[model samples]
Target chain A: MTLIVWTYIVYIALSVPLTVWVAHTLHQNGRVFLIDSFHHNEQLADSVNHLLVVGFYLINIGYVALALKEGIAPADLRQVLETISRKIGVVMLVLGAMHFFNIFLFSRMRRRALLQRVPPPVPPQAHVPVATQ
Target chain B: MNHLYVLFDAQCELCVRCRNWLAKQPTFVPLSFIALQSTKAERRFPGIDALKPSEQLLVISNEGSVYRGAHAWIMCLWALQNYREYAQRLAHPILLPFARIVCELLSRNRFFLSRALFKQEAQSVARLLAAHCRPPQTLCSNSRASV
Candidate 1:
């Protein structure tokens, strides 16, 4: 009915689907990384991946909702466009940051898991044969 | 390796304390601690005395590989769950020498460090508790009798 209402409508329409798309992309690609991190346990990897996506969605959508009424009510089409663009820009930045944070977390997990398989860094000084305990 | 055997100086309070602490930690690989002077250590590794095990850290894998000194300390950490990353970081070529120096420093002055860090505080705490928390003579006698 009003420019402000149109701005809200456009903002929600843009933000929700954008969030979903980014989430879907991450879920598909991050599966492999997660599997490796969990040492090829697909069931555990998928469970963790789903949990991470759910958390990501909750945080991003919650941010979008809370940030909805942040600025002055739009009075014109230009104001509506500006408000929507600013809101969408913030959402995209949040998404980008979350994506990178997720990558960082999974990489750390993979590094630790791989460390478990690594050989002792230094060679032993001597070998002593012994009876089994 | 599935298991590690750590030989520590039982005579040194700090080494024994460290052994106790290491024993209590959650580990990826199981650890067995043996006193360097213990007959078990002697039986398991005859001539272990010749290696001067009391002077340096010693670690034995289940497969019979012996890691001495700095490498032994790193192997000990590698067996632990939380310290494994630290062990790996310290094992880097650049850091290994530094780690060795640190381990040697701790090992060489362990008795002095133990006196400074553990014994003095423990004695102070005991003195404070003794002064502040004296039991009634009757209760003390009753407790002793129960024991």
Candidate 2:
């Protein structure tokens, strides 16, 4: 039981720093560079990050509250580790997938912007305007 | 007539939207919009290959000189005399390199964002959105140009 609790604690500890770093990157980039697309106040970004952490905490805590028994034993330790690892890994993968999907959608926009600049048709000499006249 | 021409891809929703916004800006400068996709762009500026900026924003000044990519953005900034001080500050010799770094980073994100969320078109609406003209900002105060 102690080991299971510790594993959960280690996961949370590692993710907290990583979450802050990701939020910082998002806050800085969302402003100046992608100006025309979307922007948010810096304060808002900070708030959102805080909110995300809170949400994460609530979910994980709730999960542990229900799943963690007072006496997890040495005999059952191997299965416990595997279960906890899979759950955490799946959560991380889901988060990563969401971000990747978002990025992929934006790249499609760039491609359309590129296509918008294409020429309508080739102009023939006669149909073209006579500059001097 | 002093003409500012923005050559852009018409197929891109983001580009079209940006052009529309810029056209409505109250600069009083006459602008001629050409979808580079239209032969009209080439017909207007002969001897130039139309395909070059068909995928990028091309700004052509009244002087008939063309600017592409970031330089094109610079010309637009030059025209914003009301915001000149901020523009200058952002493009300052000391600050410019950092600004470019920021610009490049933003552009990458923009490209990604457009491809991911909107899914409508490939035109990334990446912008260095200007700080608004206001008395609180130093740039607006420095502007002698008519607001």
List each candidate's DockQ score.
0.49, 0.01
Best candidate (score: TM-score) = 1
CAPRI tier for the interface of model 2: incorrect
lDDT of 2: 0.48
lDDT of each: 0.81, 0.48
Alpha-carbon shift of residue B62 in model 2 (angstroms):
2.2
Q: If you assessed candidate 1 against the hidden native complex, which CAPRI class would it receive? A: acceptable
For candidate 2, the per-residue lDDT at B5 reads 73
lDDT of 1 by residue, A13-122 (tens): 99999999999998999999899989899999999999999999999999999988846887778888888999999999999999899888888888878878877877
Retained native contacts per candidate, as fractions?
A: 0.58, 0.00
RMSD of candidate 2 to the true fold? Answer: 18.7
> lDDT by residue for model 1 over B1-147, one digit each (tens)?
688999876556677778889999988889998755445676787666666776798999888889988999999989887899888899999999998999999999986887887774445433432332234323322221210
Per-residue lDDT for A1-133 in model 2, tens only? 4666766665566554554454455445533322322233545544544554455445544544454443443336676567557656655564465445434544543333333333211111112121221
**Highest DockQ scorer:** 1
In model 1, the clashing pairs are none
Model 2 lDDT tens row, B1-147: 255677655444555566677776644245667665455555577754533664346677555667655555554554443433444465557765676566445344544444565565423321111122222334422322211
